[model samples]
Target: MYRILCVASVMLAATTATGGTLDEVKTRGALNCGVNTGLVGFASKDAAGVWQGFDVGLCRAVAAAVLGDPNAVNFIETTAATRYRVLNAGEADLLARNTTWSFTTDVDLKVDFAGINYYDGQGFMVPKALGLSSARELDGRKICVQEDTTSAMNVAEYFKRYEMTYEAIPVAGTAEAQSLYLEGACEVYSSDASQLAAIRATFAAPADHVLLEDIISKEPLGPVVRHGDDDWADLVRWVLNALIAAEELGVNSANVDELKAQGTSTPEVNRLLGLEGLMGEMLGLDADWAVRAIKAGGNYGELFAKNIGETTPIGLSRGLNLQWTEGGLLYSPPFR
Candidate 1:
């Protein structure tokens, strides 16, 4: 039933989606990408004014796949409150912001999730001084959260399920929520575990905060597009799949070119690199589409490592994000 609804909406999107967002993007010479206002490891601008991160890489990869230029993207900064409005308004061609996949947004809001690029879960962070180690102990405490996000709802649901009462402090975004939490206006800060890590890593006193081990809700964050254009939707879906598939096929940015050179001998690799199958043509792209996207910023694994790996300040281990062969949930459908 869920799949049926998604397909019906996707078909509606194909006939009416964005009124030709792809064409407009082509004429405008860029893919307008909706990104977070400033999340350090997910979607933030660097010192050179270059947008670089895991989410940013996906946007750039999509741009490279479509516009033939990785840099052909205008990153529109948006908040949790405005991210959906920004995409629905056609102000952005794609939203690679760390938006979670939910049933409401998938069907009710007319947005189609491309795929789950990052499997995450909602968790809480509090100062060590609180002496509270478990989320069950958060009763009656003040929690800071961004408005218009799943984190907000998840917090409420978890509390309700626990029959616990707490003060809900709603802020405009993560930055504001963090500020209030740091300033002691709120005792708890709740968001995706990855985001909590990103927020804490940037803090001058990183050791002061502790992320509770209890994950309250699943958060499958990924790219989203307004429903209506099947061709555009198909292109986005395949582009994302291409990235994951590249990783599965061992075709990183460094070796994609070499693998392309050594063609049909490696059937699966050839199909992904767009050398053998009609995959690229099916998506209205050239044979080298996935190559350009992958080369834009290595494969999925490479992006995760550079942006927010254990070596980085965020210091997250690729636990559930590891490829399926390695006992993780990160798997791509066969490119055949």
Candidate 2:
């Protein structure tokens, strides 16, 4: 019995030694955000090597809210296969890669998706010269797809459901898949619809290729953190919610400061921006947490517009991602 007690005490000491991610992040003074190597609208480095995108904006917002510095983040480039490994290994405090949130990934991978930032779906892109207007037309085409992603499985299922056959040329990353497709090594590139648009924009002749209208699978892409840290997870989730709520409340980066100073009586806005309440304290942060996040980047719609919306190079329509107030599905829970 004494030996068992000694072993139990040692285990308790070890558990206490490995602090939670929130405490570790507070101690380190920065956040490690895992992102894709380069996906134009989602996450990418510019000519100056500064990371920027819709997903990167979320990382910055979280850093701003937590560390009080939007740029206080280290961007770790990771591929689909390496993303989860990096998070599980403690290399990243948050996985902001444009990863799909699925039941299998959430339950089996031991990671929690904080919230859905982007609603996307798997799609097929082919050269316009192929005269294949629909996904059903590709019966036995060679397809370039990312290995170890839902894209591969979704593409296969899509074909099988149509009683078709095809050859899958698996690539390790988006760039590789784009290269193979551009070289005519594969007749089609299968990936998220937004990714297809981004890849097409990079091609020498964007007009020569076309993404099919069919959206095969539901891909709710968002930020993820390692499981077992509920406090940290709540912080991330509410940060995203704050962005969405800000948009719903007509709050933009340009007008945030003005509105905060004016001090509106709206309970939702007050709770969100912490102008009249202590919502941030619930998340173990100051009342100005959401304000800092908004200052880091604009509201959700603004970020989407600046990065990947129809006005951007990727030229994506809001489609199902528009706010419920605007006839879409982007409504957020009330802050109050």
* lDDT over C-alpha atoms for residue 173 of model 1: 83
**Worst ten in a row by lDDT for model 1:** 13-22
**Positional deviation of residue 59's Cα in model 1 after best superposition, in angstroms:** 0.5
Q: Pick the candidate with the highest lDDT.
A: 2
lDDT (tens digit, per residue) of candidate 1 on 229-319 = 6677778878888888888878899988888887757688888887786887777678899999999998989999999999999998998
Residue range 255-289, candidate 2, lDDT tens digits: 88888888787878877878877788888889899
Candidate 2 lDDT trough over 10 residues, lowest sum: 13-22
lDDT of residue 112 for candidate 1: 89
Query: Candidate 1: where is the Cα deviation over 4 Å?
Result: 1-19
Clash pairs, candidate 1, are 13-227, 13-228, 13-229, 14-228, 14-229, 14-230, 17-228
Candidate 1 lDDT for residue 18: 43
* lDDT comparing candidate 2 with the true structure: 0.90
lDDT of each: 0.89, 0.90
Question: Runs in model 2 with CA error above 4 Å?
Answer: 1-19
